[model samples]
Target: MLAQTIVNGLLLGGVYGIATIGFSVVWGVMGIINLAHGAYIMVGAYIAFALNQWFGLDPFLAMPFAMVALFVIGYALQAFLLNPVMHTSLLLTLVVTFGIDLFLIDLFVLFFSSDVRAVHTAYSGSSLEIGPVLISWVRLVAAILSVLVAIASYLFLNRTRTGQAILATALDREAARLMGIYPDRAYGLTAGLAAAVAGAAGCLASTIFPISPTLGISFLGAVFVVTVLGGIGSVAGVIIAGFAYALVQAFAATYLGANYQQIVAFSMFLLILIVRPQGLFGKPFYGES
Candidate 1:
């Protein structure tokens, strides 16, 4: 039971980690807290759901299309609506994203209603028994995809030119501009990539959990805890922190009750904030005189 619980937590954490990476990336590159990130995830889930319903496509197979759709939406939103106000106050950006979130929720509600939905595949109900642990095939695939996406993201940032530009912009926007890197372009790309990842996460999540228009709020809360726990800008930190957060939740749910899971997770979030605001892997911004 203990080992199985640990494995379950780890698997869930991987999916959670993937979902939060895009949120972290947008913040890391653009200094925007992106309150609408959950909307992107919701949109992706709907897209996959629609494809499966209409075209008989498998959710996993429909994920790319969902990702692409979200990428376009994200890119357009950043390029047209956000870039103009990029230099504005942080509060303005927050309000903008919050408004966007509300709009997305309403739009989805209008179209899909508030009914809970899930993706049903042939392998969805199947499980693998490896000695003492039994793992669901759907969850195993989601976990593997989550880890792969995170690794790919890390490699892209470290190895690619556009990614380097994004990192450079995050480090110092003025310096990045002096080097002929357009901050607007980088920001757009960052937003698009973030949305794409979020969409993929949503598609994977639909396989494991029921989704609805309002489910984004729950995901938003999870993203906040994971992001803060992992350190804002570190992919590796997010991944590790995600697993840790999942383990905590899993143990709490198993021992205490499912109702206490959120309470424990939030309590840990508060503890982290009080003890180490910079997070486990985040760099300290405050300098000693």
Candidate 2:
């Protein structure tokens, strides 16, 4: 039982990490705590759901389409709506993003009617038996996809020229601009990439969990903790902190009941904030290699 419990948590950790990476990236790069991030994921899940119903595409196969759509949405948001007041004040940015989140939620509610939905692919409830531990197929697939995406994101930031330019621009706009790298273009691209990751994660997560218009915001607290714990904007940090957070939640759910899960998680979040504010994988700053 204990082994199975641990395995379940491990699988969930990947999803949790993937979900928060978008939130983390936006914060790391744009200094914006995008409340709309959950909405973005919600949008992706709906896109996949629509594709599945209309064209019979597997939810997994719909990931790229969802990602592309979200990238366009995110880019337009940052380029047109956000850039004007981005540097005005932190509170203003927060309020703007919060309004954006609310707007998206309402829009989803209007179109989708806020119904709880899930993607029941061919292998929805099937599981693999590894001795006494039975792992759900959907979970295993989601975990694998999450890991691949996370790794790809890490590589993108480290290896690609555009990524390096983005990192440079985010860390120090003036310095990056002096080197002839445009901050506006980089910022827009960063937001687009962040949303794209969220879209992919949403498609995978829809296979494992229910989808709904309001389902995205419920994750805000947990993902915020994960993002901070993983050292905001660090892919490796999110992976490490995600697994740790999942393990904690899994164990708590088993031993302390589900109600205690959030209590315990938030308690740990406070403890970590007080003890090591920089976070598990947090660095003083990110620079190109």
Candidate 3:
């Protein structure tokens, strides 16, 4: 039973880890908290839901379409609002993102009617058993996809010219500008990429969990907690922390009781913050003033 629970936790963590990476990138490089990230995921899930309901499209296939739509939304948002404030106080950025989150939630509620919905494909509930451990196929696929995306993101950050430019821009905008890299353009691309990843995650989440306009708050909390615990800019750290969080949640849910799961998560977060404010893989300047 324990092993099975651990496996389930690990699978869930893998998806959470990938989804959080998008938040990490936007926060780490752009220095923007992007409070609307969960909303982006929520919107993406809704897009998939719409596609599935209206056109009978498969959830897996609808993901790319949702990703593209979100990419455009992110690009436009950064190019117009966030890019202008990159030079201002961080609090301003935070406020702007918070506003965006509120706007998005209301927008979704207006359009989707605040109904709780979930993708109900036949395979969503099917599982494969290995010994005593039963693994849901959807979760396994999500886990594999999450790991692949994280690895790809890592490679993009470490290997490509544009990627390097983005890193330089994040580390020092002025210096990056001096080197002929346009900070605004880089920021837009980064936001677009982050949005696309969030879209994919949202689509997957729709397949596994109930979707509602209000669920964004809880998901945002989970993703942010994992991101902080792992490190703001570290993809590898996020992956590790995601699994760690999942394990903690699963164990707490099964042993300490589900009612106490939130308390455990928060307690661990508090303990980590007190002991290692920089986080497990966070840098010295994380959440820098």
Candidate 4:
């Protein structure tokens, strides 16, 4: 039972890790809380759902389309909307994002009609058994792909010039400007990339969970908790913290009852705040600190 629980937690954590990476990156790079992140995720899921339903494309194959679409949306948001308020107080920015979130949710309801949709592939219901453990194929694929995405993101942030520039801006905007990095463009690009990652996560999630407008905010608490717990500025942090959070939830559900799962989870968040506020892997900038 314990081993099965652990496997379940790890699998869930892999998906959760991918889902929260963008939120971590955006907050770390731009200092924007991005209440609209959940909206971005929902859009991605819908994109995959549409593709699967209309043309019978696999959600994983449709990932790039969702990423590209979201990249454009995210970049435009920073260029036209967020950049204007770059110097505004954090509270104002928070309100602005909150409003954007509401607008996106409204659009989903208006168009998608709050219908719960899900993507089902031929293999979605299949599972693999290894000795006494059984693993759902969809979840296994999603988890593997999620880890691969995280690794790709890490390499992009570390190996590419554009990524380095984003990191430079994140490290110190003034210093980045001195080095000819345009903070505005960097900010926009960061948002675009973050949204792209979020989109990919949504694609992965569509395969595993039911989709609906109401599910837009489903990841809100989990992402925040994972981001803060894993430390604000790290990719590896999200991956690690994702598994940890999933394990915590699984154990709580198993031992304390499913009802207490979130209560315990949030309690851990509070405890983390009071005890080690910086998080186990917290740093000033991802990879820099």
Among these predicted structures, which one has the highest lDDT? 4
**Quick one: how many clashes does candidate 1 have?**
0
| Residue 132 in candidate 2, Cα distance off native in Å | 1.2
Model 1, residue 65: distance off in Å is 1.0
Model 2 clash count equals 0
Candidate 4 lDDT trough over 10 residues, lowest sum: 280-289
Model 1 per-residue lDDT tens digits across residues 107-214: 999999998988799888899999999999999999998898889888888899989998888888899999999999999998999999899988988888898997
Give, for candidate 1, the lowest lDDT window spanning 10 residues.
280-289
Per candidate, the number of residue pairs that clash is 0, 0, 0, 0
- For model 4, residues 111-168, the per-residue Cα lDDT tens digits are 8898788898999889999889899989999999999999999899889999999999
Question: Each candidate's TM vs. the true structure?
Answer: 0.96, 0.97, 0.96, 0.96
CA RMSD of each candidate after superposition: 2.1, 2.1, 1.3, 1.8
Two-way lDDT contest, 2 vs 4, winner: 4
Q: Which clashing pairs does model 3 show? A: none
Once fitted onto the true fold, the runs of candidate 2 whose alpha carbons sit more than 4 angstroms away are 286-289
Residue 248's lDDT within candidate 2 is 90
Model 4 scores a C-alpha lDDT of: 0.88
Alpha carbon lDDT of each predicted model: 0.86, 0.87, 0.86, 0.88
Say what the RMSD of model 2 is.
Answer: 2.1
Candidate 2 lDDT (Cα, 0 to 1)? 0.87
